[model samples]
Target: MKSGYNVAVVGATGNAGMVTLRILSEREFPLRDIVAIASTRTLGRVVSCGNRALKTQKISDINWSDIDLAFFCAGEGVSSKNAEIVADRGCIVIDKSSYFRQHPKVPLIIPEINLDTLEKGASYGIVSTPNCVVTPLVMTLKALSEVASLKRVVVSTYQSVSGAGRRAIDELYNQSKEIMTTRSSRPEVFSKQIAFNILPQVGNFYESGISEEEEKITCETRKILMADVKIAVTCVRVPVFIGHSMSVACEFSKALPTKNIRNIFEKIEGVIVIDRRGEESGYVATPIDVQGEDAVFVSRIRKDTSVKNGLLYWIACDNLRKGAALNSVQIAESMIKIDPSLSKFRKTYSRTKEA
Candidate 1:
């Protein structure tokens, strides 16, 4: 109904939020209108939606009742403070932050892997998208879990600076340019210089030694897969600008050969397998190879000899796209498919700006 399925993109000036706007227009999602939302300081700034430019509004200034859906692409602090308020106001929120992820009423979704969760039950008008590492990582694991019951998974990530936000991207570039010219740069966004090196820790470590990203990966993977499988994640921030890559090893309940793995991945949508080894093979996907890509690129498929029924592979994806914004957009798309009414504005909510 053109009467309105008006959408709001919170944190519209940021990395993930901008991409969310782009994908919505690129896919021609059936919507009445779109609004770009950012902090009050950035209000009225113009941002793009495909070829169209949208003037930004602050989240508090929005009429939540008019918003059929809200994409929370801002960081956790913004999401924690506002996601539920907007969602509760009758707008279906597809939040990219970790704030509402574990909430029992919120479904942590990855459209390609767990779109069916939309059919399960009622939600609190909020849907949570997984962490960036978990998005591509669990997409592979979800496919594998179908072939054989997963026993354990070990993954080490080469994450991009974009995952940290636009400032981190600036830091990586400025630090790199400084290192080459002045041969010196201070580490500001990261704990150490992120120019010529990789930082093994993506976030603060817990008492158990698992880093913040690692815990989110493990928990979100299990939540999305809906399995009690064990997952060990080492999230390392690499010097890359846009993509996130991972080296993964999986142990299964049955012998799943490499060829079978290739076949399974080939049949899955949004996943591309490029594993070929020979005299002429450039069949590995690096962070640079996956920039702006939508599909998860899987390569280096082989068997892990140490464990029974184990397989190993490498995967890469644009961290900002598939890992966050795109997935949130996909969630909104799938939810509309599962429940058509969610695509239109509901009049039950108060029409006034959020109080």
Candidate 2:
């Protein structure tokens, strides 16, 4: 694996895509080139990468083989179409979509838990990022998994509007403003009024009444962290623009002390343990505090009195960063570090104005 490498970011104009470039720049990913790719409509649009504005190239016509690593932050439609095209060119793809997540061959990765799975390079496959809700939940559960065998998990998410992308964020803002002035609002971006209320659904509900988003959280968590752990989840979309918060209760195979569980979380990388006392004393990781930051915050640890071997905790993180972009970029960084042949492409990505 190499220290620096050429990278591509699909859907560069979108929220997650923009944050991906920011993280790559902040971490200084070695890049000889950064192909800022988008659909034909968004081609020629510019995205800020550091002080320079990188032009968005239309992904439909690009030569995939020219890029060593392509980070697909586009929608499921684009991902299903070209993720394999990029992979077939021998370029590794770290996707931020649900497309290949359930695929038997494609590894659904949260770098903290499953980097070992990527060590063996079979085909140039896609490594899919878990849902925003799943990332924080699984990380929190990993510590608990070691202390007492995790048997079941029940979580309810308070997710931000940014999880729905820029349009939803704008809708919340505009609707709130309209209500303040006109005392009325209408549903558009979300199924109902999100300005002053919480929407219980994150995505279209399936015949089972659970959203695709909720199902992903349950299914991806089981796949990523505890394969046998039974999960029950409820997802809600809130008005906040960024970040996601989860209140989780877990039932374990054996009884354990809460203090011991907290200590294990303290040592996990990328997890901040904030268990304290009083009104401002507890571990309160707000989405605003975590926006643009790269760590999962865990607090409010206590025993769940209702169930045996049960404990309750709260977790929060910037969904776009830690949950999607940063997670995918870290996977790309991991892959390059592991593959010796890919090392030559690493270098600082510089954009120059076209003549």
Candidate 3:
């Protein structure tokens, strides 16, 4: 494999797939070629990558053997069936679905925290990106864990409709329009009314009383941080059309000052600390405000007066970009920067199965 490689953005017609193209162009990642791939129906669509226009192609008909790396932004089933085919042809597969994340051979990466895990999974034939919610929450906690030990965490997500894909965004818009016209709006994309109300469940409920979205945060956080940190998550669906936001309450091993914590977050990479002083001076980063931004916005920092070593704050990031596409692209960039042989060596001996 050469330093400059041919890369394919699978699912190029989807929301996350288009965002992947944007980040790759914005970062100016080195590439010998760029292939925008989607389903048969979307084959003729045009997507802008820098000044050049790339035509979408059918994933099934593409020659995966010519690709050096394939970014899977499509659904889990697509990734599950085709990721191995790409990998078998000597291409590194950086997947964005939950399908391969938990496999012992696959690494659920957050780039900022445990990129070392990537070196451990190259032998297994694939790499995995964590869920969008897990990315921002873990990115923020990575710095926090360094300052003081994190014992437990509680998160409530205010998720945007885009995370549910493009059709969901259209559903929200149509529903809102009907409500304004004083007409009946049927909920087709969601189980209940989402135009003006919030739903507590993001995914289906399991017998364990936790939704699948909540479980992703718990399991992925533990794997990426490599900690026994306990997490409780309540994923909520909101009317916002873009970005995902979370409110976090965390307990630490030692009491720390708010000023000191703020200072630390300011220096952490991939995080933008937007905090201020006083009652109304506090920081608040909403979905609409954070849209299209690469950095995770952190605000509303305050000490938990009840607990000896506790703190709370809000975090927001474009779920399509930083949450999925940006992070996957970052991992690929890391792989390219290192000796290509190292990726091969790491995969050859790295641990693929979990205990």
Tens-digit lDDT track of model 2 for 297-350: 988888898998888988989899888999988887777677656643222112
For 1-355, candidate 1 gives per-residue lDDT tens digits of: 2554688989899999888888888888876888999988887999988877899987778889878888898889998898778866788888899998887657788877777766565456778888988888888888888988999999999989999998999999999999999999999889999999999989898999988888888888888888888888888998988999999999999898656778887877899987768748567888888888899899988889999898989999998889998888888777777667873322233325334
Residue-level lDDT tens digits of model 3 in 193-231: 899899998988999999989988899999888887989
Best by lDDT: 3
Runs off by more than 4 Å, candidate 2: 1-4, 278-283, 343-355
Which residue pairs come into collision in candidate 1?
none
Q: Please, what is the whole-model Cα lDDT of each candidate in the order they appear?
A: 0.84, 0.82, 0.85
Q: How would you order the candidates by lDDT, starting with the best?
A: 3, 1, 2
Q: Looking at candidate 2, what is the lDDT of residue 15?
A: 87
Rank candidates by TM-score, best first. 1, 3, 2
Indicate the residue-level lDDT of 2 in model 1. 57
Cα-based lDDT at residue 322, candidate 3: 87
